[model samples]
Target chain A: MTPRARREALTGFLLILPWGLGFCAFTAGPMAISLVLSLTKWDILTAPHYVGLANFANLWHDPLFWMALRNTLAYTVLTVPLSLAGSLTLALLLNRRVPAVSVLRALFYLPELMPTVATAIIWTWLLNTHFGLLNYLLSRLGLPQVAWLESTTWALPSLVLMGLWTIGGNRMLIFLAGLQGIPEELHEAAALDGASRGRRLWHVTLPLLSPVIFFNFVLGVIASFQVFTPAYIVTNGGPADSTLVYVLYLYRNGFQYFQMGYAAAMAWVMLLLLLAFTWVQFRLMQRWVYYEGGATPG
Target chain B: MRSKWTSVLVMAALAGTMWTLGGGSPAQAQKVTTIRMVWQGEANELKLYQGLVSKFEQSHPDIRVNLETVVASSDPEYFQKVQVIAASGDYPDVIYGHYSWFPAALAKHFLLDIDPYLAKAGLAKSAYFPTAIQQFSDHGKLYALPRETSSIALYYNADMFKQAGLRTPNEYYAAGQWTWNTFLTVAKKLTRDSNGKSADQPGFNPNAIVQWGTVAPVNMPFGLFPVVYSFGGDVLDPTNTRCRLDRPAAVRGIAFLQDLLLKQHAGILPSQAQQTNLFANGKIGMMASGYWDIVVTGSAIKTFAWDVAPLPKGTIQSTRVATGAYAIPAKAPHPDQAWTLIRFLSQPDNTMELAHLGLIIPALRAAALSPEFLAPGKVPLHRKVFVDALAYGRLDPRTTHWAEMVDTLGSEMDLVWTGQKSPAAATGEACAKIDALLQH
Candidate 1:
């Protein structure tokens, strides 16, 4: 390479050095260590002893591990689709040329801005059995009050209901962008062809938005699978471990129980599962996720 | 020439920075050591601690302190924060922690053995409550200087009892009629629906009940285990090598609580137990909590009258005692300074300052028994019950596997609380799990 070319490349490399060093030290470094520790019994306090695949073998029999996995899977399944549809609906409404549309968009996105801890705290009062606003409203509607959090049957679902609070967040914004990106001519053509608005949405708008939906779907599954904070702050995997998500259990093993090896194994398992889920989604994408251009994958 | 001058200037600046960081000068006498002392508390407590630290700094000019606060909702969470900090090789000079993490901390040798320091300070074990010192020790070697001791008691709303024409818990205890049965009866009377039907009365709608009789001791150790002990049950066998919670006595104790929760519907679920100002709102007639709540809940209550009473007699009168203390990390960079800070914090005067907030029963025996702590004309009117409790109070089960055992028990207990599983079955399953943890 020419001296000038080499110099320019060197300068570019120097510019990214800070971030590169940070990624290695903070992220990659710990990850590599955790991978090693996953094969050992390290409690952060004591010296770790290499135990081969013992932690993984233990996880195979750990009832709580399976329970946490089931709970997290249930949460992800419930959250992702509902969130996808909810965000898409909000995006559709926000995509309209209504007056003060920006204000409407901001209002819809406000819940996402609140800190997770604050949201969890607020929801505790909102879901209080007797004095809760939800129960009070239910009573007014001539319905029996539901124990939103106290009962095991309802605790997980209550968390899922909370998960809906984030539907109008970034996912909606992305959907809005996708809605805007849909060619205006298609809608005009559909209308000219005497297709109803609903038909136009289903046939044209939805098809074009499919790729965005797919993107958000993949992201939502990964995000929801790692749900931790609300569960930690609110129920804390309680009312009978109903709200015990994967990460929460992993955290308990690592931090609370001081079984770092077990927690690390759980983390790796989660990473593998998430990768598999995403890969499967990609494998299934050809059937539904439409590409407007001819650059669609096999 | 300019580049060489810049390099020289850089070297001078670096030297100056190093010199300032290295205690100003090498020849300086009475070099100050800034010890990092980690602590956690609420806003008021933190403010008070800041004042106390300032006072300590004024008195010990040679010893500076960098007070670090770790915000945690629970003691175990605090332990995790310190453990993470230590794991990063940035061990704090001191940590003010609770007994909940004692076994784990002691097992890992995370704490410096304060017995030697206490000897150097000429402090005797008899100066503190025996339980306080015992909780901080293992095999007679103390690892922490006790800051405060706490005991659980029954907090009852007096107006509710008076309006119901029933004697208060303290009155019952005075007459020796304060067993679990009478406690349940009183709770039933205190509990009322919007239509004024108490739990015992006909046509009382459990669904629409506005007032709860009690917050169930469904919460761990402090809340429930005391009742277990009072019922002549033990959490662990004498050797601390096996789980005893599945024994008949323990099962009966748990069954009693389950009855209060499910059958009578007099007790709120433990999940619903500590709702924001529930007891303070006059909606809860009785609640089981530690002495710490005197400030936490009492300060919020202006519309109601309340007082402390010893927990109702089960098979025998019992309560849970626990302590919080300031411990030096084993690898502390400034161990001697940390000890000095701990000694300063645990002084009779400083402990009195801490106790005045009504947040703790000072672990210092003299300070705790003083008139200031037992405040005769206080609104609670029964502050001594906490001190009295310490006499019969049992410490929480001592096990290095505290977290795992408690989690196992808590998960099973939750099912019992929700009426999904019988107390007997749940405890049986819990013991099975806890036993596995014990064996390891």
Candidate 2:
């Protein structure tokens, strides 16, 4: 390489040095240490003993581990599709050229801005069986009251509802962008071919929106698998461990029980699951994802 | 020349920063032994502790205390922070820990033996209540000094009893009719549906309860232990190496509570926050709560009248006693100064002051039984119940596997609470789990 080009390259590297160092120090360093620790029997108070894959072996027999995984998968399965649909619907609604559209968007996005702790605290009162506003409203409408937070059957669904409420802020914006990016010519042609409004939406709009859906679907799955704060704050994995999601169980093992090695093993298992899911989605993308230009999938 | 000058200036600045960072303030010439103390609690309790710390510092001029607070939501979270501190080797010289925490701390070797200091200070085994000292010790080694002692009692709302035309718990206690049977009867009488039908009356709806008879102690140690003891049951065997929760007595105790919460529908299984404020809010007629609630109930109950009575007798009369203790970490730098502070805090005078402030039942024997704590107040008209409870109080089961055992059993107890599993099946599983954990 020429000296001038090398000098320019060196300047660019220097400008990015702080970020690169931070990525290595905080992210890579801890991850590497965690990988090593996952193979040991460490309880924090004493020196860690190299126990090979004993920690992972223990996970096979741990009932709570299976419960946590089941809870996490249930939450992800329920919330991801619901959130995507809710956000997409809101995005389509807010994308209209109506007066105060920006204000309406802002108002819909407000729930996402509230802190997780505050949300959990507010929901406790809102979901209280007898005294909550929710039951009061149901009573006014001549409907039977439901115990949203207390019953084992309703706790997970209640949290999923809360998760759905907060999706409009980020996911809806992406869907809105995807909606706007769809070529108007395709819709015009479909209409000219005597297609109905529903037909045009089905054939043109939805096909174009598939790429955005796939992207948001992958992101939502990963985020939903790591649900912790609401469970930690509100239900505390109870009524009967019904809401003990994967990350909350991992947290209990590491921090509460002082089983850092066991927690690390749980983390690695979760990482493997996420990787497998992503790879499967990538392969599946070929079947449904459509591109804007010649035979390329967005 | 300019480049060389800049390099020299930068080096000088870096050296100056290092020097300042590594050294103490220049004006503090005298060596002061700073005792690092850590505690977890609500803000008001921490402030009360801060006042005590300031007084201790004034009395002992050569030592300064650095206070650190961990605001945690629950006991497990608080212990997690303590374990993290110890693991990271940044543990405070002094720590405030619950009695139940000693077993885990002892197993980890994170606690210091304070018996030597106790002996030197002429505080013998008889200095504090024997049970308080017992709870703070493991294998005959005192690891901590009891900050205060507490026991659970029956706190009843007088207006509710009057409105229901039922005899008060205190009246029953005086009349020698305060057994589990009568307790259940009164509880049913006090429990009313929205349409004013009592739990006993036909057509009563449990789902639409307007007033609950009592607050059920779902799975708390303080809530469950006393009843278990009253039924002649023990949580652990004498060796503390196995679970006795599957025993008949314990099963009966658990069954009674489960029936109250689920079948009889006379008691409300509320959350911790709700239970704390229930009796004070006049939504519940009685509560099985610790002595610490005196202050909270006193301050919050403006429209209601409340008083305490001895817990109803089951097969026997027993209550659960709990205490928080001040302890030193095994590797504390200033053990001597930490001991001095602990001793000062546990002194009769200091203990009495804390009692007068309605913070605790002083652990010191003389102070605990004194008029300050036992004196009747307008709110809790029967303050003697808590003091009398100590006679039959049993400390929580202490073992190296306390946290794990409690957690496992608590999860199973939740099953019973939610009516998914019977008490026999759930407690059986809990006992098996505890046995396995203890064996490990």
Candidate 3:
């Protein structure tokens, strides 16, 4: 290589060195260690004893693991779509040409800015069984009291409801951005074509919104898979272990049980599951997700 | 470049100087030894400890102590954190931890055997409560020194009993009539709805009852197992190496408690708020709780009278005492200094003062029985019962996996209380899981 080219390459490598080293140290190191630890049996005190795939085999046979998996999947399925719908609806409402739209946007996004622990504490009081506003309103209407976090059946759904409260922050912002990016000429052209409001939305707006919807769906699913804090703080996987999400179980194994190796294995399994789901979503997105420009040449 | 090199040299020299000066001079170090002491407590409790450490420092000018406090939501989390610290080989010189924590700490060789130290310190094993000392021993080796002990007792609202035309629990106890059946009868009578109907009334609604006769905090297995033992079931065998939940006595005990919530509807399921509030409000006639509640509950009750009474007898006539001890870590950097701190903390005078603080029952039987400890006070009403109950109190079964056992069993117990599962079936499931855990 020429001297100038070599100098430029060296400078480029130096510039990228910090981030590359950080990725290896902070991310890749733990990930590799977790993969190895997953196949072993070790409580924090003792040295890890390699048991090959016994931990995975044990997980497969464990009823609680299956229950956690089912509960997590159910939570994700319920949360992602509902949060998407809520976010998109808010975004559409705030996309108007009304005065103080920015202020209204900020108001809707305020909850997202709150720390999760603080938000959880607020929601706990709000959803409390006897003295909560929800129950008080229900009682005023002559409805029976519902135990929000106390009942086995209602606990997971209550968390979903709590999670839905923060949906406006991310989803609304994404949808708002998507709304702005939609050119005014398309809607004007549709109007000139004598298209009705419904037809214009169906033909133009929704097609353009699909990309944002796809983005939120993937992000929401990944976030939902690792749901832990609500269950940890509020229900504690109880009234009857009804809300024992996968990440909560992993936390219990690692921190509470001191079974770091087993927890590592569970983490890798969760990663594999997420990877598979993402891949499946990519395959399925071909049929539904619409791009503003036609599909790029492969 | 010369100036930069000069700056680097100056910085290095300054760092070295600071290290030496801050580290301590060799002559001063011989006189002043820094000891790291670890414990878990509330902010107020930690403040008291800081005050005590300051006092100790002033009195013993040769020693400097650093206090490390962990505020854990529960005992299990506290034990887990300590274990991790121990495993990392960075254990503090002196640790204030639970008696249940000692077995695992011993198993991992993470604690010093303090028997020789106790002997050298002229401390008698007979001076401390036998059960408390027993809790810290493994195969005749002393691994920890008892700092404080707590036992479960039935705290009752005296006003609730009088309003219901029921005899107080102490009266029942004096008459030798405070059996589980009699306790249940009193609870049923005391439990009333806003409509002034007792739970025993024909039209009483379990879900609609406003005032409950008792509060059952299921999270405390130490409190729960007294009833289990009374029904002739034990948490484990004598060796503490096997699961005993499937025993018929244990099943019956659990069922009896479950029946109070489901069938009799006489007990309120205690929440975090209701735990301290319900008993103080005169709404709950009785509740099984530790001595820690004495101060909290006693201070809150103003309108009505309240007092502590011995727990009603089960088949075994037992209660459970939860104790904590001072332990020197095996990996302690300064073993001699750690031993000194442990001995200092466990001195009968020091322990008695701690007990007088009303936070815990003294582990020293002699101190616990002192006139000062038994003196009438806001706490003494409940403290007396705990002191008496200690004679019959059994220690919580210790296992390496006690935390997980509680998690699994506590969840299953919730199911039994909620009427989703029969006690027999729940116990069976818990037994199988606990057995599997034991094997592991």
Isolated chain A: TM-score per model? 0.97, 0.95, 0.95
Ranking by DockQ: 1, 3, 2
| Index of the highest-DockQ prediction | 1
What lDDT score belongs to each candidate, Candidate 1 first? 0.89, 0.85, 0.82
The complex in candidate 3 yields a DockQ of 0.59
B375-411 per-residue lDDT for model 1 (tens digits): 8998789979999999899998788899888878888
User: Local error of candidate 2 at A127, Å?
Assistant: 2.1
Arranged by lDDT with the best first, the candidates are 1, 2, 3
The 10-residue segment with the lowest total lDDT in model 3 chain B: B270-279
When 1 and 2 are scored with TM-score, the better candidate is: 1
True contacts kept of each: 0.82, 0.59, 0.69
Each candidate's root-mean-square deviation in Å?
A: 3.3, 3.8, 3.7
Q: Which lDDT tens digits does candidate 2 get at residues B1-440?
A: 99999999999999999999878566665678888888876766677778988999888878999888888877667877888888788868889888766777888888899989877888887868778888887778988888788889988888989988889988888898899889899999999999999999999998788888888866467788888898889999998888998999999989998899889999876573372366777888888888878886767888977888989998889999988889999898888888888888777777776677775787787877777667755457788788778778998877866666666787788888778889899989999989988888
Cα lDDT of model 3 by residue, B211-256, tens digit: 7788753544865788887778988777777789888889888888
- Point out where model 1 deviates above 4 Å: A1-11, B1-27
Q: Which stretches of candidate 2 lie over 4 Å from their true place?
A: A1-8, A137-144, A294-298, B1-29, B272-277
Better-scoring candidate (DockQ), 2 or 3: 3
- Lowest summed lDDT window (length 10), candidate 2 chain B: B269-278
